[model samples]
Target: MFLGLDVGTSGVKAILVDAEGEIAAAATTPLSLETPAPGWAEQDPEAWWAASCAAIRDVLARRPSARVEAIGISGQMHSSVFLDQRGAVIRPALLWSDGRTTAECREIVTRAGGEAQLRDWVCNPALEGFTLPKVLWLRNHEPQGFARLAKVLLAKDFVRLRLTGSIATEPSDASGTLMFDPANLRWSREMLDAVGLPLSLMPDVGGSAEVLGRVTPGAGKLARLEPGTPVVGGGADNACGAAGVGAITPGEAVSSWGTSGTVLAATAQPRVDPGLRAHTFCHVAPGVWYVMGVVLSAGGAFAWYRNQCARELAEEARDDILVDEAAAIPPGAEGATFLPYLQGERTPHRDAGLRAAFVGLSLAHSRAHMTRAVLEGVCFALRDSLEILKALGLAPAHLLLTGGGAKNAFIRQLQADVFGLPVTTVNREEGGAYGVALLAAVGAGAFPDLQTAVQRTLARRPPTPPNLDIHRAYEEVYDRFRKRLVAART
Candidate 1:
């Protein structure tokens, strides 16, 4: 058996998979994300480690230690985990969704020759959520902590260090740091210097499947694993999730709807969008690149609506509702439209002050109509990402859907209608963890290469296409959304 652990924003999940790619056992532990200030997101690094150990212990308790062969880890990308000289966390980790570093992002972009140079170097514009800006924020605000930084690590690298006593990061996760050169696959000394950060704080770069080290004796005891269990370097959660859904080759993509939504497409060459709307990063698979666009809020908007406006209905939803109330509303929500920017937006519109609203609402609209409009609004936002990919000449032939929101048949079909493409959903929703396990299997000599392992392990279901009439209707409504957004911006 191989063990894969995913340290996500909301929780930590551990999965034990056998040689045949079947899961033997799995466990999860809920985690909290703290918002100390507006636009700021933080999490205790120790909490991640504690949750991970607990998950691992629970999974191992259900199976024999002798069967466990290797371990792999995948986690949220672009989070800054600062370690002092004694290898202890100096401060809480700044997560990818945090947006407190706008000034720092501006400084870096200006120093790097503004937007043009940023696009040339990183294939994406500087954003407040990226690692470099967060580092700069610490430098300017918390000089004492900044001065004590011995090593700067991403989320998964910090977890790996606790497990194996090694400081290293894989290419996919490193690419999001804004201090690494994705094209060259190494730390960007020039960029670091430009941003007034020293390169010494960075971890050694490694490939996704590289064997960093083995679990230490103390870590082994806590997690109930065999000492010296080989630990392979996995990657960013989205990249690993993409791999788990078999989005490995060109013309294939993964559309994930979690707290935030993203559309990822793999390619052989790194292609930056001319508008700087999407990010191009190194893939976990060697010699490959993937482009991604992020929407700040997707499922999060629906959650807010359920908690705020539909509380009573939510309590009775399970038993009384035949289909999800949100799913029952007709296409276009009877001419009503929603702007899903409660937390602002990332892709296409890099606006931080953007607010959400339901426009064109009428007295005839019901609760189901509003709920369905929320879901469709999320899809429309993702379609902006798809349109950007299409403009970049990396149009995907099919899309693999994953994440909590993808479980809803209504939302899945809504995605199909919005994008006018065939949407495929996988049986395994443990995308990042499963992908990490597949990487561990390869690192432990269970497979020869990533491609072969993916081919053998990933299971696919039939494609669900959009209804032609609904698709046509959406095309016209989407045009109106575009026009309205432009007018609002003006």
Candidate 2:
């Protein structure tokens, strides 16, 4: 059995897969997040550690006889976990979704000489989501904590250090830090120097599939795993997610609508958007890369709608009940559009100050129309990423849909309509945990590579083809949505 741990923002998921790529057991333990201030998302590193151990122990206790051969870890990218020389977490980790570093983002650009130079150094624009901004925020606001910083680990690497006693990272996770050179596959010393930080804080880089360390006896006992279990240098959640969904080949992509939405496509080379609109990151597989566009609010926008607007729903317990309510309304929401920038936008417009609104609302429009507008709005926001990827010359054969948003048939069909492409989902929707399990399978010699492991493990659902007629109608509505976004900025 290969064990994979996805240390996510909401929870830590532990998945166990056998030699045939079949899941033997799986468990998820919820995590706690503190928005101590608006736009600041933080998590206690201890909470992640406890949740990871609990999830792993739950799965292991369920299957005591299963011998785990290797381990892999994947997690939310670009979260900053500061550690002292003894490797103690010095402060709560500032998460990827945290949007409190706008000033620091600008500071980084100015320090790098300009936006163009920063992109030249790291192949990514300085966004609040990236780690460098978090580091800078820490330096500016928490100088006492900054003085103790001996090492900086990404989200999963912190968990890996607890499990494997190794201080290292892989190319995929490293590339997202805004301090790593995605093109060269190393830490960006130029950016580090520009920020006046030492290179020694960065961990040694390795391939995602390579075994980086062994499980320490202390962690092994705590999690009911064998000591000396080989732990691979896994990957970022999205990279592992792509591997899990069998989207390793070029022209294939995964459209994930988790808290934040992403449209990710693997590529033959490390390709960056010249305009710095999309991000290029190393894939879990060697010699492979991916370009991705993010929508800061995807299902998250739906959640906000459900809470703030859907108090009258009969099925309040069902989080996706809004989609069902919206299902009664046909395409285009009868000329209403939603901005869906509740937590600000990411893909084409990297504006953290932008907010959401519903346009073209009339007395004739019913509550259901407004609800469907929200659904269509989320899809349209995701479509922004798809458009960016396509602009970069990527034509995905079909989008593999994942996340809670994909559960509703109406939402799935809505995505197909909005994107004008066929959509499918894998039989398992384990997301990053399943993906890293494939990486562990490769590391454990259960499979030779990610492609074979995915082929053996994951099965696809039938394609949900778009209705060209309905799709044609949505073009105008989507245009109105885009126009609202443009008008909002002004």
Candidate 3:
């Protein structure tokens, strides 16, 4: 058996996979986020360690007799975890959704000469969510914390450190930092020097599936695993999620709508978006790269609507009630258009200050109409990146839909209608945990590489082809949505 751990924003999930790429057991432990001020998202690093251990133990308890071979980890990317010389966490880690670094993003671009030179160095623009800007925020706002910072690690790397006492990172997560050169597959000295930070603060970079270290004795007891269980350097959640759905080569893509939404396409090379709209990052699969567009609020937008307008349905554990309500509305939501930029956006707009709104709302519009529009808006935001991918010649034949919203037929159809493309789901859609488990299989010498592992494991359902009539209707609604985005700048 191989273990895979994903340290996510909301929780830590652990899964165990048997040989032949089958899951033996899985478990998750919930985590909480702290937003003490507007636009600031933080989490206690120690809580991550606690939740990871709890989840690992929960899963292992299910099959105590199973012999574990190796472990792999996947996690949310672009978050910053600061540590002191003693390796104690210096402060609550800044999260990817945190938008407190707007000024720092501008500062990074200025320091790098401009957005053009910044993209030239890192293959991405300076975005508030990226680690580079978060680092600058620390220096500018909390100089004392900056002085105490001995090292910085991405979310999963910190968990790996607790598990194995090793300091390392893989390229997939590193590429999101705006301090990594995806084209060169290394830390960008240009960006580092421009920010006045040292190379020593970063973890050593390695291939995603490489065995970084064995489980330490202390961590082994806590996780209920044997000491010396090998641990592989896993991947960022999106890269691992892409791998899980077998989006490992050109001509393939994935569209996921969790709290956030993203459209990812694997490429043979790093393809920088000239407009700096989409991100080009390293894939967990060696020698492969991917272009991804991020929507800061996707399913999250729907959840917010549910909490504010339909709390009873949510509290009753019937989110499908929402689907039933929204599905009854027409394709265009009766002229209502929702802009799901609640937490700012990362893709085409690159605007962290953008807010969300319902355009053309009136007394005639009900919660159901707005709900349908919210769903449509989320899918359209994903399509924004799909359009960019198409322009870059990285278009996939179809999109593989995954995440919390993918389970509902209504959402599946809504995505197809808005994107004007066939979409499908895979049987093994356990997100990052399943993908890292497969990576662990490769690291444990059970497979030659990730490509062979995925091809052997993945089985796709029939495609959900787009409804041409509804797709036409969405074209008009999406146009309204694009035009109304200006209203969200407030």
Best by lDDT: 3
Predicted structure 1: lDDT: 0.84
Model 3 misplaced regions, further than 4 Å: 314-316
Instruction: Write the candidate numbers in order of decreasing TM-score.
Output: 3, 2, 1
Q: TM-score winner between 1 and 2, please give it.
A: 2
lDDT of 3 at 136: 83
Off by over 4 Å in 2: 311-317, 362-367, 486-490
Instruction: Determine which window of 10 residues in candidate 3 has minimal summed lDDT.
Output: 311-320
TM-score of 2: 0.95
Candidate 2 local lDDT, residue 319: 58
**Can you write out model 3's per-residue Cα lDDT over 135-196, one digit (the tens) per residue?**
88888999999999988999999999999999999999999998889999889998899989
Residue 43 of model 2, lDDT score? 94
> What's the true lDDT of residue 385 in model 3?
91
Model 1 poorest 10 in a row by lDDT: 314-323
Q: How high is each candidate's TM-score?
A: 0.95, 0.95, 0.98
Please write out the lDDT profile of model 1 over residues 1-490, one tens digit for every residue: 9999999888899999999888889999988989897667899999999999999988888886537889999998888998899999999999888888888888998888778877767666788778888888889999999999889898888889999999999889988988888887878877887877788889898778889979999998988777899999998988888888877777789899877889988988888788888888888888889999998787677766777776556475631352366566778778778888776678988876566888788999987778777788888999999988988887888789988656777677888889999898776778889889989999999999888888888778888898889999998888867666743332
RMSD of each: 2.1, 1.8, 1.2
Error of 3 at 107 (Å): 1.3
